[model samples]
Target: MTRLGYQVPNFTYPGVGSDGLFEAVAAQAVEAEESGFDTVLVMDHFYQLPMLGAPDNAMIECYTLLAALSQRTSRVRLSALVTGNTYRHPSLLAKTVTALDVVSGGRAQLGIGAGWFELEHDSLGFEFGTFTERFEKLEEALRIVIPMLRGERPSLEGTWYSVHEAINSPAPVGRIPVMIGGGGEKKTLRMVAQYADESNIICAPDEIPRKLAALDEHCERLGRDRSEITVTYQTSAVIAPTKEQAQAELDAAVAAIPELAARAGGVILGSPDEVRPIYERILASGVDGVTVNLPANGHVPGRVALLGETLAPVVNRS
Candidate 1:
């Protein structure tokens, strides 16, 4: 069956931008669990925007939030939508995730991607390499991380990172799924075919079919089944009771995110009945899961509840 998931924003800069930070997240996690959402995902970004209050707002750290969140919600799975490779050493990352898995009782999944957003790197003074260099770093980091988690002591020297005898203790007692982020067909998908347990593609629903074909090609090249990697997405949305309410919500969301709105047109602005077909179309693209972007603040908790309780029920899977 196609799995359904939800993503809390990477930036806390929702409208009326208070550093509500993750204080609201704990509540949403509970709501998601009760509503039957399968996975509760959070985006990884270190900086706060103007609307989010300040450049360095009252944001909570991801690992800390995850720890607290694990305690708050019993059933739902938790993960970063994707962690940045540049933020921590691969060894440290693997170690941290191992701990999270242990505490969460095997409920942790690690999603990582090449780091972008030059502002965070520059402001924090972490090395902000070129895009190509970041991708290279991610490859080596994944290599170092996965093996260490499996109790293999791997030694590696790469352009960006090197580890020798980096021991990850109390190895992930479960599969500890690793999801590579991005739909960069040439580079990212190739990495997923060889490395990741999952990969994410962000596009309009119509664009997913072509990307899936490319992923299939990558799978063939790796002599692996495309089914081996779970395909997921970050799609726009709006859930309201009536056509007028949906339109009003969409209008508010667009005003809040003029750029994102212009880039994507309207979000999934409709009632559950109106929106179910959009999800069905997504499944037709061979997607096994989806992580709907909680693009707005006021609406997100309610929308997440609706998705778990309503939309997920009608999605047909074979």
Candidate 2:
């Protein structure tokens, strides 16, 4: 379980061009590892998310970045916040994550979800199906992916995917925990109960209780123990050494990306003393852990470190 995780959702840092982009990313990962964060994640998308920036903004491939970060930092577990299932075949994904686990010396996890970014799909020539169709594909993909990750040769014939005695050699160095990301009551949470080792609920803090109840219901229907799966919450944060500085950062972020203003309530914004209780309240809502993406000033040196310092004690306390 990831008690505290840092996500790198933006790559367009000020003053750093393409030549120093990877190094900037690497520096944050190293800092997070040293600062008490147990996990580090990156978004899995070919193009920048519209809520964050223009389509032409710098965006690196997810797994390649993780594989590279694995060499740069050794302690923090690495994964995509969630890999879009429609982007790759199930067996191949299992193979890729298994290789990541090997290279990372058993510090790799597989975080995945049903594909959602239609613009990326349409631009990249990948099939962008209906919501129902995408969920169907995700279900079929999991059936094949789960067994393969456990070192079994799975044979499956389904509507969206098919595999016959699929082989995944050089099995993962250790168990590669499957983390499913989403909070939909019907399809997403049900799939999380049935297949995933971890469930990342993407909702506002006030909504976590309802989402957890939905997940509990699914676990009950499936006759699976609720404790079998770990639950985590996903949200954005903007923290500074002082309240005024934090507000300035938030204001700047909302100015640059107007969409963020609409979702400001879901974001944690303040200094360490101010935000610690916010996180405590979130953890009190019953999530086993939390993963935060620092979209406002994460690329700035020591920003991620400060976030980890503030959050690690709050989340990891016994």
TM-score of each: 0.88, 0.96
Error of 2 at 201 (Å): 0.9
Please give the distance, in angstroms, between residue 39's alpha carbon in candidate 2 and its true position after superposition.
0.8
lDDT score of residue 13 within candidate 2:
70
lDDT (Cα, tens digit) per residue for candidate 1, span 93-175? 99998898888888888889998878888988889878899998999999999998788998998877888888888877687
Name the candidate that leads on TM-score: 2
lDDT of 2 by residue, 1-318 (tens): 677889998888767899999999999999899999999999999998887877877899999999999999989999999999989999999999998999999999999999899999999998989999999999999999889989899999899889999999999999889899999989999999999989998876789999999999999999989998999999788889988988888788777766567656667889999989989999999999999988878887888899999989988882
Worst 10 residues of 2 by lDDT: 257-266
